[model samples]
Target: MRDNTRPLSPHLQVYRPQITSILSILHRMTGVTLALAALLLTYWLASAAYGPEAFGRAQVLLESWFGRLVLFGFTFSLFYHMCNGIRHLGWDMLWGFDMPRLRITGAIVVITSLSLTVLSWLMAYGHVGKL
Candidate 1:
């Protein structure tokens, strides 16, 4: 009844990665990233509440190059997660199921997320006019 020669199921190596699959994986990863970022946010807030010295230390760390890099990643992950969630909402409504539309929406999600992240950083650094 069992055949040792045949594979039981398709493995990851059997197929090439597609945009849909990649985006889905990225969405899950970004969700985890956001959760971790929340812990950092909590640390910052707690420092502010603790005292001026604690807050200053927090500020110094946050303003460092490595800190800015982490903050940038957190910002991008936040936007990407939000955009992908909206795409999922459309899916919940029975939309964008076709291959073409799926690709288009996936591209839109990536572009919009990156754009928002960059724009926010620009505004934060006063490179663009404040709202």
Candidate 2:
């Protein structure tokens, strides 16, 4: 009698990612970054409520080029995570099960996420609005 309590599954390190797997990992990473970004936003808001001095420092930090870049990345991550989450929910309902549909939807998720992110920042910075 063989004891199969430990199934002969391949180790994670042995497995190379296909496109879907890579996108799945990116989804989780973006979600985590979005969460941290939310917390940072809350901290900045609280600083604003604290006093003028607190608000001034927060504003200075936010105005810094590096800080603005970080915020921009966070904004993009937020949208990317949301788009990917919707894709996962669709899959949960047994949608996009075909290989072609999966690939197309995956591409759409990535492309729209990037496009929307850029568009959002452009609008926020008060430059381009349409397209």
Candidate 3:
């Protein structure tokens, strides 16, 4: 018996990632990650309902280095998602449908997301440093 498994289609090797393409892909990925993070909120709330120890453990985990990295990623995702979301809404309102404007919007979204992420972390860390 001959088994037939069709080879996959062209991958990243086929097309280089353009700004718009990367931003678009990352927008969806970050949205999914944010949704997962939202579930963590729900989990914590549920833990509080169970007992104090459970909640404390959750808090400890949140305070860990792994947790901090996850939180930072979450923050970055949130800003990226928010910026890209506005771009999507603009499209919904029938604006920036053209290639040039879309590319500009993508660039703006990526830049703003990175800036906001860094600014937010700096603000948070700055306050912590003074204390």
Best by lDDT: 1
Candidate 1 wrong stretches, greater than 4 Å? 1-14, 127-131
Reference-based TM-score of each model: 0.86, 0.83, 0.79
Clash pairs detected, candidate 2: none
By TM-score, the better pick of 2 and 3 is 2
Across 11-118, the per-residue lDDT of candidate 3 in tens digits comes to 545778887678878988999999989998898898899899999999899889999899899999999999999999999999998999988898898899999999
Rank the models by TM-score, top first: 1, 2, 3
How do the residues 1-131 of candidate 2 rate in per-residue lDDT, one tens digit apiece? Answer: 98989767545457787778778878878988888898889989999899999989998998799889988889789888889889989999999979898889889989999999898887877753442
lDDT of 3: 0.90
lDDT of 3 at 116: 99
Candidate 3: RMSD over Cα atoms?
3.5
Highest TM-score against the true fold, candidate:
1
lDDT of each residue in 20-102, candidate 1, tens digit only: 88898899899999999999999999999999999999999999999999999999999999999999999999999999999
List candidate 2 stretches off by more than 4 Å: 1-12, 127-131
